[model samples]
Every structure is written in structure tokens, then in C-alpha cells.
Target: MCGIVTAIATNNVVPVLLEGLRKLEYRGYDSAGLAVLAGELTRLRSCGRVAELAALADARQLSAHIGIAHTRWATHGVPSERNAHPHISGGLAVVHNGIIENFESIKADLQGKGYVFESETDTEAIAHLVHYKLQANTDLFEAVRQATNELVGAYAIGVVAEADPFRVIVARRGSPLLLGIGEDGMYAASDTAALLQVTRKIVYLEDGDLAELRRDSYIVIRSDGSPVEREVHISSLSADAVELGKFRHYMQKEIFEQPQALAQTLELIAGGAGITPQHFGARAGEVFDGVRRVLVLACGTSYHAGLVARYWIESIAKLPVTVEIASEYRYRESVPDPDTLVVVISQSGETADTLAALKHAKALGMQRTLAICNVPESAIVRETALRFITRAGPEIGVASTKAFTTQLAAFALLTLALAKINGRLSAEDEERRLAALRHLPVAVQKVLELEPEIEQWAQRFAGKEHALFLGRGSHWPIAMEGALKLKEISYIHAEAYAAGELKHGPLALVDKDMPVIAVSPADELLEKLKSNLQEVRARGGELYVFADAGSEIPESEGVHILHMPEHYGMLSPVLHVIPLQLLSYHAALVKGTDVDKPRNLAKSVTVE
Candidate 1:
């Protein structure tokens, strides 16, 4: 994933373009560049964050009425100035997101055509192709369209021409691109967040769609140059969605908002206003009742959510479940039979690997596919037969916090619904679980209140470069998720181990500087997890635990506890996750890392 922004206006547009790039910076930060048409060819590029590029552009006085900017997450080449975006060929410049699968073949052919390439990026090939085509056809739109026809695979392209300084052309394949119409100018960005300040009315470009924008007018067209009608949808996001408010980082703001996010999700599902488990309860039962097996495919934190779902489906729904990492699931030739039900979980609902896995399962004739996603209109939601939306609003942070908890809530609700349909649980049992589910928001809120203590503990472990997360049973996956978050944003090398597996091999990593974060919530495995914590402490590993309020934590040793409210067995994971999320947030804050936009990470992975 990468961020792209284009602006064409009659007046100065550099400020607007810079503001939009700042909004879209969450998408990528490996490098940043901008191309401006200021009566002459002018380009500003850098090998770091958007701030660096902005400083360089400011020094060069590169202001223009029409421009395109990009914040790159390097995929085709190494992160360097030579490999940055806004690759220019002759009088044409282009910025792109998403991979060009046939780029090597295209590059070889273009090289044979006597085209000199400046950088080893797939995007440079497109610039050369556009320049070559414009030699025969002077029209910029036609040249871009002809160039895109030769390219294969995913791309969201923004192009500007020195010959036509007042115009900008954009096209989309598999990645996202949006158009914002304004009074004096028009803006094109990868998401609404980038253009919200300029205009609230927007148009989302579908695959194979092209748009030509000018200072006074904007038009949408099909790939073949035929005019098409476009819908301008208004965004529901407010300014506060992007603001950190009182929190120091978006990760921490998002972590503290989990109580409300979970509540909103539960309300959406239980309120019956939109799609919910009740709508699919009977159909889900019918599908799973005759099904012999279940498959869960996801990536990153969503994958950990699936691991938690595996426990619920096996224990409550009484079904055999398998969790597969989406990236690996499609590469393997093992295909699910028609009788198996496949569940795909994603926060963005546009994760590349997960989408590929869904397609692979469908191609294998697996009919019953369900998507649990946060974005209601995401690509995966449209492709799946059934869908459940997790109402965790606008997760701006690159690392997930509320999305994980909401996915767990959705999985738990799905499990209960399946149990009711399969006759695995009686009406009383279903009601009891539903009641527990209703109280989860409050339980989660209680755990979130422990953030103060968790932050205090975070300071003590901030100097440590490595940590261990230990849990057993359902908490094992929660521990894994915690460790992953810590490593993702904090740059801390953390590992998760099943309490029993600690001494097997991972225990060797433990030392005085290694702090072990244990998920010892009050569950069936509480005693076993406590014993594991003791084992780590005996080895000079600092013990930081999230324990139940009434659990006996040994005071004789160096046991630091952030007590959580006692909740039902399955619901504890959702509550226990908040403290760990806060701990990671504070740790990353202490480390002075860019928590919202972590290095070499993007908010969405739209390209394969």
C-alpha cells in the first residue's frame, strides 16, 4: 500500500497537496516525492518520511498550480531516492501504488525499444510507456489509457504532463483512488481522509476506471474512453476521527476507545438495524450443520483473532476448526471440499493475501464463505456470500487495537449463533452466553481502566529490547497478538510462547533485561500460567502480568500485576487484550517511534 494525491487548480495548490499527503501518510512512509508543473519541469523527492520531502520541496520553492505527490512503501525496489515515486519520462511524470505483476516483461520490452530507465521500479516503466505513446498520440488521457492496457496486475496511477500543465489523469485497477471536486480545484487521493479538508463530496474510482480532472471540470470514463456516470458519495468521518485528542499517539487513543468501539459493535449487531448474526443465524446453522469441517483464513492481527475463534468454534459450537495464515493457505495445493465452510476475517476487508485465499477457496467449489470485516463496503465484503461488519470506526493507527477486540466479539457471537443452530447448546445456554456477551463492553471498560498501571509498568520495561509474552489456552493467541503489536510499533523483539513450551526452546532468550508479559487471566489454565510465571521469575525474567482481581499473585517475588475484572471464560480474551494493547502503545511512545505510521508498513495491502 502507498499514498497518492493529485491536485489541479487555477491558484496555488502545493499547500493543499501537502495537507492531503499528511493525511494519507498512514498508508506509507518508506519514501516520499512530488512532481509539479510550474511552467517548467520540477521534481522533489526523498528517501524518508513525508516531512523530509516537504522540507526538501520547501527549499527548492517547488510550488505549482497542478501536482501529484506520493508516499511510497517500497515493493519493487529498495527504499532510496532513485527508487522513489513520481518517476518522470520526457515531459510526463507518474506516481503509482500496487504491484505491476508483468513489470519485468514490460521493462525488458521497453528497454529493447531504446527507452532509458532511471530507477528499478515498475512505475518507471509506466512513465516510459506513456512517454512513448504520447509521441504518436498527443492526448494525455489516450496515452495513459493505451499505456495501462499493456500493463497487467494491480495499480492506482496518477499522472501529470508538462504539455498539458492544467490537467491530471488518474486510473485504478485493484487499488483505491478517490476524487474530490472543489470550487477552485479538484483533488484525487487514495482515501477520504486525505481530501476531507478540501471537500466532503467524493467519488471512488472502480477497477478499470479512468478520470480526467482539470481546474474547472472533472470527468469519469471507462478504459475504452467512453464517458460514464460517477456517484459522488459523502463521507461520514469527522475531523476528530484523525485527531489524537488528549492521547499522545493514535495507537493509544484507539486503545482507550476500545470500550466504546466494542460497545458500538455490540449495539450494531444486537440492535438489528443492519446485518447481524440474527439475520444469518438460521442460514449459518443450515450451512454448518451439514458441514464436516471449517476453515478460517486471515492475516496479521486478524489471524490471531481466528486462533481465538478456533477455541470458540471447537468448545462452544462443537465443530472441528482449522486456522490458516492467508498468505500460505493459497500457495499450498490443499483445497477444501464443498462441504467445508470458509471464514475470512479482515479489518480493511482488502488485505491482498486474504482476498487471494477467498478466491482460491471459491475456485475450489467451496460454496459457503463468510466475511467478517470492519469496512462494510470493502472488496472482500462484496465477494463473500455472507458478511458481518465490525463497527470499529476508522482505525487510523497502522497497528490494530479495536479491530482485534471487535473481531473476537464477532467470532464469539458467530460461535454462539452456530451453537444455537447446530443444537449443540440449549436455549438456556445460548441465553447465558448472550448475557455474558452483553456485559463484555463493561468488562472491557474495566480492563481499560488499568492503563495507568500498565503505562507505569511500561516505563520500567522501555529500555529492554526484547520481551516474552506467555499464556495458555485461549489466552495463548492473545499473548501472540500482544507480542506482535509490541514488535510492530515499538521495535521491540518480542515472542509469544505457550506456557508449557517456554522451557522447550524460547526460554533461552530470557535474561535479566528480558521482561515477560504474561496473560494470566482467571481461567481454567490460571494455575498453570501462574506456575509458568514463577518459572520465568526464577530465571531473573521480569514478570509483568494481567491477572484477575482475586487471583493470588506471589508478593514474595517481583510480581507486577495489573488486575482485570473477572469475566466469563471466552470473553476474557477480549478484555485481557486491552491492557496489553495499552502497554505496547505506551512502550512505543516511550521509544519515540512513529506509532501511527510504523516503518515499512502501510494501512492496507491492496496489491499482491
Candidate 2:
């Protein structure tokens, strides 16, 4: 994923462009650049963070009435000044997000036409193609639209033509782009957070929609050049929501926000006596009635949420569920039934692979669809028939914390709703389930209190190069999520295995130097999990167990116990994952690693 911000204003837009880039840096930070049109196209590129780019801009006294800026997560080329965005060809400067699958053929054609290519980026090809289109049509909007017609694959591009200095042409297909209406100017960005300071009114562009932006006005048109009206939504997000008030990093702020996040996500049920299917959407009860099975499509942390959902849906709803990684599922042939409900999970709801997979499922005649997402205006939310918007607002960390727990909270409600609809849940059981959900925030708050203890454990983990995470049943996915968090932030080589699978092969790697972290909930599998922990101890592996309160597990020389407040039956995964996240966060701190913007990772995966 990359971030793009464009502004056409009466006053100098250099400051606006720079501020927007700073807000959007979580999307990508490999390099940053800006292109402004004063008398001609003035371009500045940097292979550094936005701060360095700002320094360069100040040194050069860059100022313009219209400009576009980008912070990139490199795709087609390595991170360098030459590979940064604002890829220029003749008079056209283009900044883009998403992949161009047919770039090789397009690049060859452009090269054959005697056009010189500067950077090894697909984005450079778009600039040349738009410049080429300008020769036939003098209008910049028409040139961008015509050039896009010849290109394939996903793109959200902002183009500024030297001839049309006051105007910016933007187009989107399979990537997020939106226009912000401001009193002084018109703004376009991949995310609303970028333009929050300038505007609160946003117009989300549809696929293949091309827009021409100028000071105080913007016009949106369809691919066929037909004019259309897009509704402008009043954004609830404030500039303060993105600020890191007193926290060292956004990750820490988000970790503490889980209590409020969960509370807001579960607000509809917190005061209710029982749960209902209508909590999902107006048409959810009808959609759930037709669902005979469920197929979950997601990627990354969202995929792990889907894996945990599998156990809930099958056990509570008595529905067969298959969780598939969206990236893999979209490219493979699979059985798709119209009666099957396809549930897609994403924090941004603009995840490229998950969105493609949703379209793929719909193409195969699966009409029943649902989205569990954080953003209310995201593409995945609009594409699905039903949706549950998690209240985990603006997760800036590349490694998710509040978003994951909120997804689990949303999934728990979905499971209860389905169970109630199918008669699997009795009235008494439903009340009990609802009670557990109502107290989820309090339970999560109790878990947050254990952070100090977990931080102490992190000291032991920080110096280690490798670790193992073990759990059984539904907690297996929790273990996997734990391993992912540790590896992602701390750069530790970590792996997770179902406790039952330990004897199969993984037990061989256990030693005194290796830390074995176990999720030991007091369920029926606790004894078996204890045996797995013993297998590690027998081989001199240091065991760090997060056990249920009142569990028989004893603390000894190598066996360390961190007791959870309570053993939540089905909702344990949500609570158990908190300490693991804390451990990873503290471990990353101990190692002095970047916790928010981890290496080679962006917060959003908007590209394939």
C-alpha cells in the first residue's frame, strides 16, 4: 500500500501536501516525494521519510497552488530517489497506488514509441502513457481517462499536467480514492485521515470513476464520460483521533483503546437482554436464513480472525465453515454454493486480496455475503450485502491490536445471532452468552492490568532469537496470532503449533534456550496441553504459561505461570491474545525495534 495526497487550492498547497503525507505515512514510508505546478511541473523526490522530504522542500523553497504528494511502499522497484513517486514523463507527473499487471507490455509499447523511461516503476509507465494521451487530447481529464482505458489491473492515480497547471486529474479502480470538499480548496487522498485537517466532508469515488479537481470545485465522471453525482459523507473522524497523545507509539495507544473499542463495538448488545440478527444489518436476518454454510475470506491478521470464527460458527451455529486465506482462495478453483454465506474480514475493508476474493465468490454465484470491517466507508463494506463495522477506529500500527480483538468481538456476536436463529441456543444460554459479551470490555480491561508482568517476561524473550507458541482447540489460532505478533515487531523467529502436534515434529527443537509460550485455558484439553508443556520441560525448554485462574498448573524452576483473570469459555481467545500482544510490544521495545512501522510492512495491504 502507498499513500497519495493531492490539493488544488487558492493559496500555496505545499504545507497541506506535506501535512497530509505525514498523516498518511502509516500506509507507506519507504520513500516520499511531491510534485507541484507553478509555471511548470516542479518535482522533488526523496528516498527518505516524510520529514526528510519536508527538509528538502524547505531548502528549495517549494511552493505551488496545486500539488500531489506520495509516500510509497515500493512494489515495482527498490526504494531510491529514482524509484520514488511523482514519476514524470514530459509534462505529466503521476503518483499511484496498486499494481499494474500488464506494465511490461505497456512499457515495451511506450519504449518502442521512442519514449524514455526513467524509473523501474509501473507508475512511470502511467505517466508516459498519460503524456502520450495528451498529444491527441489537450484536456488533462480526458487524457487520464483515455490512458486508463488501455491499462489493466488496479490503480488509484493522481496526475498533474503542466498544460493544465491549476487542475488535478484522479482516477481509481480497485484501490481507495476519495475527494474532500474544503472551503479553500479541493483535496484528494487515499484515506480520509490525510485530509481531516482541511475537510470533514468526503466523497468516496467508485471503481473506474475519474475526477477533475480544481480550486473550490471537483467533477466526477464515469469511465464512459457520463457525469454522475456522488454523495458526500460527513466524516466522524477528528484530527485528534490520529494523534499519539501521551503514548510512545500508536501501537501502545491502540492496545489501551481495546476496552473502549470493544465497548463501542458491542454497544447494541450491552444493554439488551438478548442478541438478535438485526444487529448485523437490516437484511442480515434474511441473509442468515438462507445460509447453509460459511466460507470466510481474509488475509493477514484478518485471516487469523477468520480461523477463530471457524470454531465458533461450527460449534454454536452447527454450520460447516471453511476459512481460506483470501490471496490463495482467489486464484484457486473451489466449490461455491449460492446457499453458502461468504464472510469477508478486513480492518480497512480495502484489502486488495480480500476484495478480489469477495468479487470472485460473487462471480461464482455466491450472493449471500457479509463483511466484518472497521471502516464504515470502505469498498469491502459497500460491496458486501451485509456488514458489521467494528468500532476500532484508526489502527495506525502495522501489527493490529484493537482491530483483531474487535473482529473477534464482532464474530462472537455473529455466532450468537446464528445460533439463536437456528435454535441451537436456548433462551437461557442466549442470556448467558449476552452477559459474557456485555462484560467483554471489563474482562479485557482486567487483562490489560497484566501488562507489567508480561513486560517483565519480555525481558527474557528479547535476547532470544527464536520462540514457540502452543495452544489447543480454538486457542490454536490465538497462538498463531501471538507468534505472528512476536515475529512481526521483535524480528524474532517464532512458530506456533497445535499442542497435539508438538509430539509430531516440533518437540525436537525444544531446549533450555528456547522459550515455549503456552495458552492453557481450563478446558477439557488442559491436561493434554499440560502434557505438551511437560514434553518441552523434559527437554529443558523454559516454559512460560498463560494459564487460566485456578488451573492446577504450578510454578516451578522452569515453569512460569501468568494467570488470566478468568477462563472465558468461547471468548478466551479475545482475552488470551492481550498478554501475548503486550509481550511482543515490550520485547520489541527491549530490542529497540520500530514497533509501529515494522520493517517492510505497511498498515494497509491495498496492493496484490
Candidate 3:
């Protein structure tokens, strides 16, 4: 994901634009740039961070009443100052997020027209096309609207021009864009946090909505040239909430925010009223009552949440659920049951593959859809028939910590709700699950107290090249997630097995040098998992185990153990994941890898 911001104010907007880019640093950090209208379009760019771009703008005294800025996660071009953002052409500049699928063809068309390109970015194609339209039409908003029609891809754009220095034009097709309305100015940003400092009055721009922002006001128009009035939503996030206060990085801050985030997610259901399909949406009760089966589509960490939910839904709700990676699900042929409830999970809710899979399912006649997402107004939420917003606030970390836990928490509620609908949830079961849900935040908090212990294990992990993770049943997904976190942030080669599969194949790879990290929570599979650990021990594999207090597993003969105060039963995965996040954070710190922004990884995967 990339960040785009622009502002039109009665006074110089450079400060607000720079601050907006800074707030959006979590979205991207590869390169940043800004273009302003000070009698003429002046563009300043830097290769490293928004601070560098701010310094460059300061050096040139870049002051303007109208400006556009961008922080880029390189997609079509290399990450460099020359290819940063605000691609300028013919006195007009454009900042764009999302891929341009037809850029090569558009580039050829622009090149054939003798329009010289400066930056090797697909964004430059939009600038040239806007310039081309500006030549035929002098109206800035009309030119932008016309240019958008010729493009074929997902995009959120902010355009500024020397010809019309008092106004900024903005539009979005797939990526997010919002308008901030204040007394003296108007603003456009890719994130609400960017505008939280300027104005709490936020307006989410829908797909195909084009807006023109002037100093005092703004106007939004539909693709068909119809005037549209967008609803203004008052935002609740504060600047302090997103800042890394008393924390080393955004990832670390987000890891600890799990307790608060999960509390917010569970607040509505903590009253003992029990979960109902209405928690998803108003029509959810009707849909849930009709569907005979469930099909879940997701990717990465969100997919792991679905994997864990498969165990909960089948056992507790007695429902048949099929979990599929969204990208894979869209390409293959499947039996599309109209009675199936298709559920899509995403932290950003704008994942391209997940959105496409939701659409693919809808096209195949599965209209009963649900979205488990963090963002309230995202593409998946807009497309799906029902949705449950996971209140994880904003996860800045590239490797998900709180979002995954919150998703699992949402799944727990979903499973109980489904059981209630199917007549499988007894009054006693409801009381027990709701009590567990109410106590889950405190349970997660207790888990966070183990960070120092996890850090010690991370120190040992930092020296290892390969690791093995083992678990069983619901905890197997936790093991997979732990392995994913280590590999994603720390660059560690880690593998997870169902623990029973160890003797079948992965046992041959076990050695003393490769530390085996086992998730040995007190569960029904504890005996089988312990037998698997003996096989690892006999083969000279060193083991680090996280076990319940009464599990009887101890630190003896090359095995290291961390004892949990108590077992959380069905909700153990939520508690077990915190230490793994701590492990990844400290391990990445030891290995000196970029913890928040890992190599070749963007916080949001907007493209397929």
C-alpha cells in the first residue's frame, strides 16, 4: 500500500501535507515526494523517508496554498528519488496508489504522442493523460474525470496543477481515499489517521467517486457526472493512539495493544446477551438461518485465522466449513452451492485477491456473504452482504499480531452464533463461552507478561538458521502463525508440523542445531504431542516448549520449558500468539532486520 495526501487551504498547506505524509509512514517508507503550486508546480522528492522529503521541501522553501504528497511502496518502478511520486507532466502533477494494469499500453500511447516521461512509474501515465485532457479541456476537475475513464486498474489519486492552483482534484477506484472537511480548508488522504489531526469530520470516498477540493469547500461527483453528497463520519482515533510513545517501533506498540483492541472488539458481546447473527449485520440472521455450509476465503495471517475457525465451527457449531486461499479459490473450479455462506477475512479489507474471490463467489450464485475485517468502510465490506468489523484499531506491523487475534476472537463469536442458530448451543455452553470471551482480554494481558522470557528464547533463535514448530488440533494453526511471524520479520527458516507428521517426514530434518519450538498447551492431543517430542529428543533435537502449568513437561535433557499460569482451553491460541509475536520482534531486533517494514513486503497487498 502507498499513502497519498493533498490539501487546499487559505494559507500555505506545506506543513499539513508533510504531517499527513508522516502520519501515513506506516503505509509506506520506501520513498516520498510532494508537489505544490507556488505560481508554478514545484516537486521535491527523497529516497528514504517522509522526513527526508520534508527536509528537501524545507531546503527549497516549498510553500503553497495547494499541494499533493505521496509515500510510495514501489510497484511498477524501483524505489528511488527519481521514481518516488507526484509524477509531473505539462504543469500538472499526480500522486497515485495501486497498480496500473494497462500502463504499458498507456505508456506507448503517451510516448507515441511525443509526451516525454520523467519517472519510470505507471503514475506518470495518469499525469500525462491528465495533461492531454487538460489541453482539450481547461477545467481541472473535468480533465481528471476524463483521464480516469481511460485507465484500467485499481487507483486512488490526488492531482494538483499550476493551471488551477487554488484547488486539488481527487478520485479513487479501488484503493482508499477520504476527504477531511475543516472550517478553513479541505483535505484528501489515503488514511483517516492522516486527517485526524486536521479534522475529525471525515468523508469516505466510494469507488468511482471523483472530488474537487477548494480551500473552503469540496464537491463530489459520480462517474456518470451526477452530483453526489457523501456522508461525513466523525472519526474517533486520536494522534496519541497511533504514535509510538514509549515504544521502539509501530510493530512493538501494536503487539502490546492486543489487550485494548480485543477488549473493544468484545465490548458489545460482554453483556451476557450471547452472540447472534445480528452481530455481523441486520440481514445476517436471515442469511445464517438459510445457509447449510460455509466457505471461507482469505490469505496470509487472515487465512490462518480461518484455519483455526474450521476447528471451532466443526466441533462447536457442527458445521461443515471449507477454507480456501482466495487467489487459489478464484482460479480453480469448485462446486458452488447457493446455500453456502461465503465468508472473506482481511485485516485491511482491501486485499485484491480476497475481494476478487468474494466477487467470484457472488458470480457463481453464492449471494450470502460475510466479511470479517478491521476497516469499517472497505471494498470487501461494501461488497459483502454481512460484515463484522474487528476493532483492532490500526495494525502498522507488516506481520500481523493483533489483527490475527481479533479475527480469531470474531470467529469464536461467529461459531457460537452459528451454534445458537443450529440449536447446538445449550444455555450452559453459551454461559461458559461468554464468560471465557469476557475474560479473554485479561488472559491476553497475562500472556504479555511473558515477553522477557520470550525475548530470552529469541536471543537463542537469533543464532539459529532453521527451526521447527509443532502443535496439534486448534493449536496447529498457532504453530503455523508462529513460524510465519519468525520467517516474515526475522528472516528465519521455520517449518510447522501437526506434530503427528513429525515421524512421517520432518523428523529426518531434526538435529541439535535446529531448535524445535513446540506449542504444548494442555489439550486432548497432549499425549500424542508428547510422544512426538520424544522422537525429536531421541534424534538429538533441542526443544523450546510453551506448555500449561500442569502439563508435566519440564526443562530436562536438552529441552527448555516456559510454563503458562493456567490453560485457556478453547481460547488458548489467542494467549499463545503473544509470545510468538514477542519472539519475532526480539529475533528481528537481534538479526537487525527491518521489524515494521520487512524486505519485499508491504503492509497491505492491494495487487494480486
Would you list the C-alpha lDDT of every candidate in the order shown? 0.85, 0.93, 0.90
Shift of residue 296 alpha carbon in model 1, Å:
1.4
TM-score of 1: 0.93
Each model's TM-score, in the order given? 0.93, 0.99, 0.98
- Regions more than 4 Å wrong, model 3: none
Q: In candidate 3, what are the lDDT values of residues 1-608, reduced to their tens digit?
A: 89998999887889999999888877655999899888888988888878888888888888888899999998877888889888988888999999889998989998999999877889999999999989899999999999898889999999988878878999999888999998779999988888877898999999999999988889999888799998999887777878889999988999999999999999878776777789989998899996789999999999999999999999999989999999999899999999998999999988989999999999999999999999998889999999999999988778899999999999999999999999999999899989999999998888889988988888888889999999999999999999999999999999988999998999999999989999999989999999999999999999999998789987898999988767998899888878888888999999999898887787777778
lDDT of 1 at 219: 90
lDDT of 2 by residue, 1-608 (tens): 79999999998999999999999987757999999998988999888689999999999999899999999898898999999999998887999998999999999999999998888899999999999999999888998989999889999999998878878999999999999999999999999999998999999999989999989789999999999999999999999999999999999999999999999999988667468889889998899996899999999888889999999999999999999999999788898899998999999999999999999999999999999999998999999999999989999988999999999999999999988899899988998888998999999999999998999999998889999999999999999999999999999999999999999999999998889999999998998998888899999999999999977899999999999999999999999999999999999999999898898998889888
Residue range 1-608, candidate 1, lDDT tens digits: 78999999877788887888888877756888889999976888898777888888788777789999998888888999999989999988999988998988988998999998889899999999999899999999999999998889889999999889879999997787889988889889988888877788888787788999999899999898899998888777776687778987778888878878888777844533322345443366456567667899999999999999999989988889999999999898895688887999998887888998999999999978899998765778877878878888888889999999999988887887676667787867766677777778888777777777887988886798898999899889999999999999999999998999997988888878888888887777888887787788788887888887677775546677777768557788888888888888888888888888887788898876
In Å, residue 505's CA in model 3 sits off its true spot by 2.7
* Model 2: per-residue Cα lDDT at residue 183: 92
Candidate 1 error regions (>4 Å):
59-63, 224-230, 269-291
By lDDT rank, best first, the candidates go 2, 3, 1
lDDT of 2 at 488: 93
Between candidates 2 and 3, the TM-score winner: 2
